[model samples]
Target: MNIKEKYELSSRYETAKKDYEKWGIDVDKALDILKDIKISIHCWQGDDVTGFEANNQELSGGIAATGNYPGKARNAEELRKDLDKALSLIPGKHKVNLHAIYAETDGKFVDRDELKPEHFANWVKWAKENGLGLDFNPTIFSHEKAADNLTLSSPNKEIRDFWIRHAIASRKIGEYFGKELGQTCLTNLWIPDGYKDIPADRLGPRKRLKDSLEEIFSVEIDKKYNLDAVESKVFGIGAESYTVGSSEFYINFVNKNNLVPLLDTGHYHPTEVVSDKLSAMTLFNDKVALHVSRPVRWDSDHVVIFDDELKEIAKEIVRNDSLDKIIIGLDYFDASINRIAAWTIGSRNMIKALLSALLIPNDYLRKLQDDGNFTERLALMEEFKTYPLGDIWNYYCAKNNVPVGEEWIKEVKKYEEEVLNNRK
Candidate 1:
């Protein structure tokens, strides 16, 4: 077996061991190698069988409440329960994506009545008490005028004010979460302040959003708080149509703000820009984290698929050294049937894609390093494009795949022996 096969086999064993541990089943074998698998799977509150079965079992994290879920926690008390449930499912080291507040005047952002320190204190306390990890994503469009919901209004003052307060509050929240949790604060800031009917050069809202972020970073959040600004696409109708979270804007905004950019795959799949999305992310690997979920053209399916199109995008992300930035959480809507199972299936497919990326022959990558040819690298990607990304994993994992495991372990031993002999 080659080096890639060696690592793949070792990874499979390590993940299997971890999976067994969850059910109180221990594997009596060497598992020192899985210590390096840094990938994480995303989970949400309602996810049940589908999401669970599809989960990497080896690596999983708590779910984040998508702002649209009306039944989810909107207050500290509700959040505590949410945190508790999430913590109960995963291992001790997993994390949770916290929806800081529903950003509508009619929602939690305003219901809290001017965003007090205690409201946030409640969240921090809950996380600490439950040992649940927390992340942040603001629902900025919740308060817009009924008619002007996801776009910039004529005055746009209320929206601007909402964001100003939100930015300030988020910064404060980031600092508190970081100091209190020892875990970095991840703020997924989605810009809903855009044009609806006609393009609005209403640069004021954009400027305020950016300035607020910069000011927050300057004034709050320790270096650990990764303020990942997410640009999301909103799906709706006529007067309320919105799509500010596109590659066109995010690439420039992140570069300009000196903050990390987050891309939601579902947001752009409808636009046929998945490849461009990957290209932009590749160039900005140093400043991007992926929100990987399935997108069905016009809607945010949040389903995960190993579709050929997404498969290629996944390859590019892994090839570009950006897998570390990926947070594999399901963006599934709570109202969907078998929602949890959907998340699991999607997550399973997602892990398969990630494994495929990991198994890509290192020699091919090394050749790119040696040649320093950018075009050649892209061509190489095209060359190995047809391989079933995750099926290699299923082949060994679905049954008594022990032979696959032994063959791989031997390969690793051979590599180790070669390296030790060379050193001597």
Candidate 2:
């Protein structure tokens, strides 16, 4: 599939007025700004697969561990009700990923005895009714029980065995989703499968990782469908810090199996300089799909806070005509921040970043390319540094009469203030 088919852009906007007031932007203007660009917005946040409190379906495995809806939702019906609320809020083309709950606890898997096929059907039906496509992650099958803490070097051989098995299982799950969903869905697999320590644990597990990709890539398909595997990294915990090396490693791995690799912007923040992040993307440009979000020291997938430096890297990606290769989604969530806001802000910011990058004059960009300082010059580009991609995005929501309340403004203002003060 082409970049438009693969990325099919999207974001979350809580309300029109808030979007407009914040940036005085609108949908048509946003559309004109992004002319010929393919964009899709959210139907709603999916549940967290890990069972962590308040599951946001941005990624799928975490909610399954808890075996209950983090939203305290009682059944598939209630889940539908909540999702319906989200759908109504947006009222158009939809893009969504499945939650970990559906994989592990929603009564659909053979390994999890509690799953009922009817419940699963109802969930899919609800999504289809609203015109939203499923972003599937199959590892929900592994949540049948809690995972024993496993690292490559953990004392227990069982933990090592579990990781290997889980990797294989995740691929199978993706294949299953492809079959079950038929042409009605799209899948993005962000594997949480990575070593928590150095390579010595089995040293051979990297081989297992390759085997996992092979399984997913080998799937048979008859129609256009998007399959993306996100290379995600966790920060803060040293023991959990092993996965991801050079961009070369990512390209080599995906190229070996003929699978696409997703670049989560935050994953590179704590290590791998920003310029390398772009180079990593360039190496896999044909197979790249950018995952956008802010970085906190060691903490990741933070709220959609735009960084000029990060935008510079992204701008070059866009100006070089790779923007079409990106499907921007929010990699953020918070107990304190309204979940919907996280989606809207992160998505809006990503669109803004792309436009800001595109607004730069071609003459200047060519100079950077010639100077061998393209990345740095892109970073210093004035338009990308100041353009408001969200002005029209914010305005369109208000024109449609979507509510953008004062409190929401207060929260966003606070966020801006905090971000600015930190730079000082």
Candidate 3:
């Protein structure tokens, strides 16, 4: 930004800081904490969920990324380059979440079940050079094996075993990522094994799924190298009647197995929000993994905006002082707009929401509630909403040496013109 813009942002931040000080909130401390918060950006966003598998298959498993937006990364090299640009605009050192299908197999057809850490060596090297960590997921869809809408839960033993092997392979790769990068890699398992129509025996499929997961976890890996998490969804496009891996199922399994339960913001009913579930999970689990996204009516996987739910999710994490215990990651793919802009916008807003939460006077608010001053507490909450949050957010972007506000758009547009358009 220009000098004038920097001066204006600094001046505004000073005024906002003074206002926050009255409420016992430390703006500088909040900024420092915000800098440490890292949100893992999903790699699939750059390629529209189309991984670098040799077959060039379409997305499946009741999930699909709509829109035919141009310039989708066609290979690992292109995807990494796009991610590098996205990371450059986003502040703070973060991690990249990769799917098993994105492994660089060097033109060899290494199926998911046979995936090894060497397949992702290029990604590990790139992440290390870029000062980023890595997370992993096993891809269990868009393949002939998953065409029946069944994977780990399939009655057919062969199909179920295939997915089980893939899940195990994914964990091993995640361990490699953590070992090489010196950061714990969270290996999450999410399968689309369900029925479009109501099933006569739901218990059977769930039992089979449990068995598959049990077998996958039987081979123990060190927790220091890999952390295992399971994600569930209420429903999906094809699996409207039932989803084998429901929230209740995963929650019970995670609790029983001492594994992390992942909560995806877009994986619930329209009326339900993950914000209200954070405190409960924190109470039960030592750590939780979050998949941040925006859901219009269903699991639409829309680009995350700075909405009320987003702010509330951030507030819950900050108020409970669970920043260190929560693993934040973005999980959305919107090919409708400029992909890089989508990444930049969603990531920056998530950071802004956290900053807003950190700026709240949590101690004072809790004390007010404990003293039975509900009226005053409610009034103060409303007043805090009108505070100069935007000014503070602008100041944060400036401090990070990134563009303040809309200025970042110019950089993304320039890249799109100079690079993305030439992909074809």
Per-residue CA lDDT of model 1 for 208-281, tens digit only, reads: 55555555445545657545555545433332344444455556767876667676665554656454566566
TM-score of each: 0.62, 0.64, 0.98
Model 1 TM: 0.62
Give the whole-model CA lDDT for all candidates, comma-separated: 0.48, 0.45, 0.92
Between prediction 2 and prediction 3, the one with superior lDDT is 3
Against the true structure, candidate 2 reaches a TM-score of 0.64
Better of 1 and 2 by TM-score: 2
- Model number with the top TM-score: 3
Q: In lDDT terms, how accurate is model 3?
A: 0.92
Q: What is the lDDT of residue 36 in candidate 1?
A: 28
List ranges where model 1 is wrong by over 4 Å.
1-93, 102-113, 116-132, 144-147, 150-154, 199-218, 226-228, 232-246, 269-276, 282-285, 325-329, 365-424
- What shift in Å separates residue 54 of candidate 3 from its native position after superposition? 0.7
Q: For model 3, what is the alpha-carbon lDDT of residue 371?
A: 100
State the lDDT at 61 in candidate 2. Answer: 27
